[model samples]
Structures are given as C-alpha cells and as structure tokens.
Target: MSIVDTSQKQRGRGVLEGAFQVLDALSRFPDGAGLSQLSRACELPKATTFRLLEQLVELGAVQRHGTEYSVGHLMARLGENWQPHPRLRRASRGPIRTLARLSTAAIAVTILDGDRVRVVGATRGTPGELPHVMADSASVSRTAAGQVLLASQPRRERPEAYTATEWRRLRSRLRQDDAVVVEYEDVLPGVCCVAAPAPLPDGQGVASVSALIIGSTVPSALPGLVLRAAGEISRGLAVH
Candidate 1:
C-alpha cells in the first residue's frame, strides 16, 4: 500500500482498539458510568473517550443518559446470539445450583479466556452474599477459579503473578490435590473460595467450579464439596 494509505490503516486500527477498550470498560459498569470514570478505566484521554462514546452511541452499541453512559440495546441484541461455551454452561447449571444450595456458598463455573477468566454460569447461595468477582469477567491472577485453570496451562502461558518456583510448587499441589483454596482480602475482606478443575472426556482440564465462602470461617468440607461439583460437571460434559 502507499505510505498515506498505510498511515490511514494504522490510524483506523488504533481507533478500533480504543473503541473496543471503551466498550470493555463500559461493561464493568452495568448501571452506568460517567465520562471521567470511563476515561480513567480505559486509560484514554477524556476527549478521545468522549469521541469514541459518541460514535458508539451513534451506532447504538452504547446509550447515554445526561452525563452517564451504559451498554445499549443493540449490544444486548448482539450478545444474545453469542454463546461462548454452550455445552459447558448447560452441563454445569445443575451442579452449580446444587452446590450453592448444599454449601450455602456462591458457586461459579469459569473458563479461561486468554489472560482472564470468564464466569460462564453462577448461582448465589443466599440473597445478597454474591462476590463482585462472580461477575462476567475477572483477572486470572485474582481468583481461585483462575488459579485452577492456570495450573492446567503450560508454564509459559501462566501469568507472572507467581514466581517460577512458586508456580511450579503451587501447580503441582493444585493438580495433585485436585483443588485450590484462597482468601481474597482485596476483592472482598473475609471471603474465601475453593476451586477445582472440571475435566473433559479426554481428561483435559478446560474449566473450573468455584465456591465462594462469604464469612470468616471457611467450612473444612468446602474444598471437597467444590471438587465433587467439578467432578459432576465434568461427567455431565463427558456425556453432552
């Protein structure tokens, strides 16, 4: 391509990236987010963020209400047709609900998505005890479910939150024991989570089932309960 053409293409690519970043950041604010909040979240200049938001609103991918913006009906319509892991979500639904009921802990089924973990299905134990991380997406380094999925990955693919030696030891223990338990003081003080890998028919671990204990005391049997639920989901996926 000509030099001018190439420069135009690069600028177009940059704008596209910026737009998607804005959308991703907007997803974190379900109700709505003001321009300054979104700009900071997306790490884009306020003017640039506003320009992108205007374009997105024009295309119906975003909606604006005075100074706040949120995802629009058009995006919702598009999302309705997109199913990331249909079989996995369907197979885990029953086990997730059962686990939540039995343990009285919030339960989630998550799958690795690049360096992040996406919650495919979730059930609340009580009316208002859900963790914020139980949302649609979370960082791989911050969640027990993410750790279970990361343990199944090759060393090079793991996140840098753990040192090499630490990762090796933790991965081995997690794999051998078939579960991992962690407490997150930053995400939510006094919350603990137990996660176990859900394997496929060929014995490849692809997803995880996690139970979030909301109180200070994590039940001694919670890890085993999560492991059982993960196994049940794996069995269901095997036949699906």
Candidate 2:
C-alpha cells in the first residue's frame, strides 16, 4: 500500500478500537478507569492509550481528570439525543416492572421536556386503570406525577414560590424533599402518583419513573414505596 493509504488505515483502526475500548471500560466500571488501568484493561500500550484519550477528549466523548479516564458529556448526549428506541425502555424495564409488580400500580419511565414529562417508555400492569403517563398531562400542574417532578425544580420554578399561601406551602415541601403530591387534585380523581428525582449524569431531571396507583389501593405508607422505587431506578443508572 502507498504511504497515504497506510496512514489512513492506521488512523481508522485507532479510531475504531480506541473508542470501543474506552466506552467498554466506562460502561463496565462507572467510577471510571485510570490511564494505567485502561492501558492494561484495553491491552493497548500506554503511549497509544494516551494518544487516543487526547483525541476522544477533543471530540468530547471521553474525559480525563488527573490520570483517570471516563465517559464524558458527549457520551450522555449520545445516549439522550436519539430518536425513541428500545434502549430507554429496556434500560429501565427492570425497575419499572419491579415497582409495578410489587406495588400493583402502573409503572412508567418519563423524560422531562421543556414543560412536560413525556412517557417515553411505559409498561401496563394487570388491569392497568390509572394513566399518569399521558403526554397531555404535561399541561396539568395539579396531577401527582406533575407535582412530584415539579418539586424537583430549583427555587425559581415552584408554584407557590411566588405566591402568598401556596408559595409558603411549596417552599415547605421543597425543603422536605424535591418530591411532592396533592392527591385527587391531579388527573383522575381516584388515582394518585408520587415522584422522586432522577437527576441525569448532568444536573437535568432527564427522567423520572413513577408508580400510579388507585387512591383507594394506595396504602397509608405508600409514599415511602414510591420514593424507594425512584431511588432504585436512579441507582441503576450508571453515574459518569
């Protein structure tokens, strides 16, 4: 092969193998792998690993701090900036299914958009009757899912943050936990939901998984269950 062709082939190999090796390490070990560890784990020489790390950093796909390397904001964009796929559902299915089966409630994974919580992934429970995952609910601020997600807002977004009585109430709830609920006030007078924060790798409330159950069926101590379910989902999400 000519000199130019040989150089191109070498670059291509580096790009393909280097990117995969870095991603695989980050995925398998969320805490991130240091340069030395990556060198050994990827079985690439330290010199080559250092070169690829620099390239990926420039491309915003990998991050290096001190001597460690890990998935970066670019990886997050790749995961979140796609058309709907089975991965989101598949990634979250375990917790959603567990919550629904354990609580006998409709479980859903939601993404927070500009002013809405979208039902990007859903799973129906037996005789699923409640519907908090409806995309249209994005407009209704009085519902359970909406209220819980709304609680996650910074001080500027609270309903009562600017008001007289409601602001005080909202501040109180926000102080307690970024989770809130006002039963029967949301959609479907008989159904109620509660939410917990699912802050993404970045600070954005990228998504929330919720349990929507009939008010009558909800036990007196159900809020704990709801909160725990959200916590489980958050734990499953690998931190970058």
Candidate 3:
C-alpha cells in the first residue's frame, strides 16, 4: 500500500482497538461509567476516549446520559452475550440470599473490576438492615469486600492495584488469613462485616462474599457462616 494509505490503515486499527477497549471497560460497569472513569479503566487518554465515545454515541453503539455512558439500544439489540458478571450474579444469588437469611445480616458478592470492587449480588437480612457496608462499586481499599478481593490478587499487584492510602490501611488492618476478615463499624458506624474470598475450581479467587451485620460488634458465628457461604458461591461460579 502507499505510504498515506498505510498510515490511514494504522490509524484505523488503533481506533478499532481503542473502541473495543472502551466497550470492554463499559461492560464492567453495569450501571454506567463517566468519561474519566472509562478513560482510566481502558487506559486511554481522556481526549481519545471522549472522541471515540462521541462517535459511538452517534452510531447508537453507546448511550450517553448527561455525564454517564452505557451500552446503547442498538448495542443491546445486537445481542452480544457471554457476560461473566451477570452469570456470576445469577450463580451466586441463591447462596448470597441464603447467607443473608442465615446470618440475619446483609450479604454481598463482589469482584475486582480494575481498581474497584463491583457488588454483583446482594441480599438484605431478615431483621431488615440496609447494606451500607457493601455499597455498589466501592473502592477496594475502603471496604472489607475490597480487601478480600485485593488479598486474592498476587502480592506484587496489590500495591498499585488500589488507592495507595486505603491499600496501606487495609494491608495493615487485615490479618493474613485465608478464612475471613472481620471489621467492626469501619466502613460505617453501627455496621460490622466479615469477608472471605470465594475460591474458584482453578484455585484462583473469583470474588468476595461478605456478611454485613447492623451491630456494634462482629457476631461470633458470622465469620464461619460467611466463609462457608463464600465457598458455596465459589463452587457455583466454578462449575458455571
């Protein structure tokens, strides 16, 4: 090809790659993502992501609302399937609910998405408590769920994977235990939570199962219950 044609082709390839990255990043956030978040998740320059997002918005491949972006009507109609998060949610829903009922505390399933923890599944306990401890899309360094997911990752990846200050605090406070880590009223006052890493068939940690109780002290039996529930959810994810 001629030099100009070759240059154009290279630029076209780059655009295509960038577009795919943006889509993949957006897919991670079911609720939607802002431009800066999308750019950071996709590791692209804000300007480049902005231009491509604008094009995608125009093409109906992506929808933009005031400041957030999500898969558009056209994209949804195109029927792209094989979303792991949704599948994980479905698999863990029953176990999570069971945990919540058994412990009389809210239970949440979270996975690391980029530098944050995404709560894919959650259930409030029978006593009627809100899940302030397991908020949707919380930073990994600030919550027990985030800490579990972070601990599951390789050691070298931990330092840079989350917010530096929060990571440091989590590292210091979270004991090196494979079972469960209990935090009392750290994320929110009057709310205590215990978290365990859900292990997959391959022995890799897939998610964190947390039991959030509305109390001043961590329940004695909550840690074990959360651990077993986490294992059940892990097995569910493994086979699926």
| Full-model lDDT for every candidate | 0.78, 0.63, 0.74
Identify the candidate with maximal lDDT.
Answer: 1
Q: TM-score for every candidate vs. truth?
A: 0.61, 0.50, 0.60
After superposition on all CA atoms, what RMSD does each candidate show versus the true structure?
A: 7.1, 15.1, 7.7
Tens digit of lDDT per residue, candidate 3, span 28-84?
888999999999999999999999999999999999999999989877776544233
Question: Which residue runs of candidate 1 sit more than 4 Å off their true CA positions?
Answer: 1-75, 125-140, 155-158, 184-187, 201-205
- Candidates 1 and 2 compared: the better one by TM-score is 1
Candidate 2, residues 196-216, lDDT tens digits: the string is 555454465545566677764
> Candidate 3 has what TM-score?
0.60
Candidates in descending lDDT order:
1, 3, 2
**Which parts of model 2 have CA positions greater than 4 angstroms off?**
1-91, 125-139, 155-164, 175-182, 215-217
